[model samples]
Target: MTTVQPTVVSAEAVDVATRGGAGTARRRPRGSRPFRSPQAQELWGWTFVAVPMLLFLTFVIIPVVMAVVLSFTDYAVIGDPEWVGVENYRRILDDPIFWLALRNTVIYTVMFVPLGVLVALGTALLLNRSSRVVNLFRTLFYIPVVASTVATATIWYWLLNPQSGLFNIVLGWFGIDGPAWLYDSKWAMTAIVLMSVWSGFGTNMLIYLGGLQGIPRELYEAVRIDGANAWQSLRHITLPGLSRTTFLISTLLIIGAFQVFDQAYLLTKGGPGNSTLTVVYYIYNQGFGGLKMGYASALSFVLFLIIAVFSILNFRLTSRRQS
Candidate 1:
């Protein structure tokens, strides 16, 4: 204790030592700073985005650019692409098969979109009440959406079989002869539309459910207090509340309808005189089957324009209604 002479610490030593103990001075390098600098932040941000941006450029942008360039040429998956100006696009106008496919696609959209919206809304309305059984039904209905499209097409193929099928057998109970569904051109597209609606409506139903939940319970309570019936509440409150959701679902339905391929391809093969030949299927036939890549690209662009126009129209109509 005596040896621990009253040592006076120098200001320099005190400055270098931590409060708890003496240690080596830990000064940052001259002009160096923490990572909070704007330059550092921007560096990290770019590092995060670089991979995704690269991928998008590689897969999406490059392919789209290539398709545009190829659309103006004659590429048949063989030899060099020959420059053909707008010959492919001009050919589209004179192609009766193209017009037929476009007509079928429009018909399918008209039937599928409205029916899909109604079914989704109706299911969502029915299941809005919270209950375990209702949750179970929701899960069951969504199963079809997750199921393989090929499997769904296969199931419907048998279901619509003319001689020995569930649909015809059920109709016979009412003393009604069901038409040959996939075999007859008249009913083939209708049969495909029904299958499509059944397979896809579950997704839109979930979307409607989300929209329903977002509507304030207070609104429903207020309507009920004023003696509003269920239908009246639905008409005044529910429908209006779900208008945006309806528009979104309808737009998606319209796009998918225009791109209809799987069911028509699997069940009908555009058969019975190309009754169910959708635009996408025709595009496929030209691209791969017929090996006319350039024409397929032109058709694809045309379809894209159609989908864009319809989606824009849908948005405008929805906005007008909301206003």
Candidate 2:
């Protein structure tokens, strides 16, 4: 009788613990489906990813494929596409205007990249402080980036006026005559370069600020304790630390410089003997203006090649220097 009572009491205790006095959830059956299977989870993940993948395939991949196919054919949007094989590619070799546009683009890239980097770095260094005024100034500098390109170009148009522009007015203060910027071919490109540097450097400056913040303040303090002057500190600590940032900014600048169109289109309109005719502008003129879509596609691929080559070279050079 005692043995049976003890067994019964133990069974009751085990039952109560298993029930957890109604505060605990009931254990699910072994075959219950409260959670998804691995395959179901995987399918849901793919369902979400498929949306963007579908859009990319429909827009980007399809258009690129179509462009490649169309580059070998003559299509003017109205007429049926006629196959021309390598004729368009061959014609590019003899296209003088294309060559001129390429040369002009090269010149713009050369002038803009270094100047843009310097301006952005300088502005970032100036604004790399913690104060209300400095924050306000940073916002002010970034205003140009948020402003519409057309609006910025319009503002610059008035500023670059030959006779009564703000630029010439400022030059008059020093008794130096400012050249007719947009009107004169010699100065037209220079004007474009200046405007580009001003309008685009704001973004680069923000990027530099991010990089600057990432750099350890301890290094600066260490250098100061070692009797390093401002310039020396910048040369050793600041410059070396920002090498990656410089590489990124310069790469972006190079890409944008090569594909310059909006500023030249809005400001110069490729005027004054086509001096400011960039490759992208020429491509625009060819495709839409002249209705030579096939040729334009060919030119686009050529420009793609050029940009790729330059980008690779930049990466290699920057990597070598860093190493």
Candidate 3:
């Protein structure tokens, strides 16, 4: 009688406890639910995420939709947006300045991508050792990367200044005359590429540094045991170990180079016969400056398409190389 009564009491206790938790909750046959009301729990779950979800829909979703709709129209931010079908897109094909901007962008990307990767890789290789001095140098290198685009451009503007600038002064010390960087059309883009590489390589350097950590130390020891020199070890192991990192940095560099805007706008202003008029800068000029928002939107999409194609190509090439 006592055993049976204990079992009955225990069962009743568990039932009571389950029902008491989470007000208005139902008792389950087997498992105890943490909350009483499923709907109430669901409501609170949604409440927590409601703000971010609303923001995403409002800003990202709505703007993308508006841009797509506007791309098909001739809205100058004035009267009602006039629907022009594919005329805006068709006009882009015949626009001479569009081609020029694209050519300049391509040139910038070609120069910037390889140089950016090499600088980042070289710096990472140089600084990957475990030492306080290495850490300090790494921090110093990364400082420029975190600086705002405007700030970096302003500093470079002064550094690359003609006649009185630091670059010309240094060149003069070597009995070499530095070309007018900011004013010379032929050299302006080159100067921009150099500045970009210096300013941006630090980020990829960090990425490469992290990738270095993932490489096994025994690999280096194995190479050393085989009488491998520094150059051989680097060529065979270090570069191979960083293939994935290189691919990622290369992809990012391509995207960023294509979107080159702030530097050109702040330092060069697409001057010297529009030598630095990048695709994004051209889009900005047409969209906001000239109030041809619709055409600019179309240009923006074209740029998006170009970036997408290049990104896909990069992925395929890397994958093929790996395979």
State which candidate has the highest TM-score.
Answer: 1
Which residue pairs collide, candidate 1?
none
Tens digit per residue, CA lDDT, model 1, 223-243: 999999999999899999999
Work out the TM-score per prediction: 0.88, 0.88, 0.86
Q: For each candidate in turn, give its C-alpha RMSD to the true structure in angstroms.
A: 8.8, 9.5, 7.7
> What is the alpha-carbon lDDT of model 2 when measured against the actual structure?
0.91
lDDT of 2 by residue, 155-271 (tens): 999998988899999999999999999999999999999998888889999999999999999999999999999999999999888999999999998888899999999999997
Candidate 1 error regions (>4 Å): 1-33
lDDT of each model, Cα atoms only?
0.90, 0.91, 0.91
Clash number for every model? 0, 0, 1
RMSD of 3: 7.7
Rank list by TM-score: 1, 2, 3
For candidate 1, the TM-score is 0.88
Error of 3 at 107 (Å): 0.9
lDDT at 39 for candidate 2? 88
After TM-score superposition, what is the CA distance of residue 171 in candidate 3 from its true location, in Å?
1.5
Higher-ranked by TM-score: 1 or 3: 1
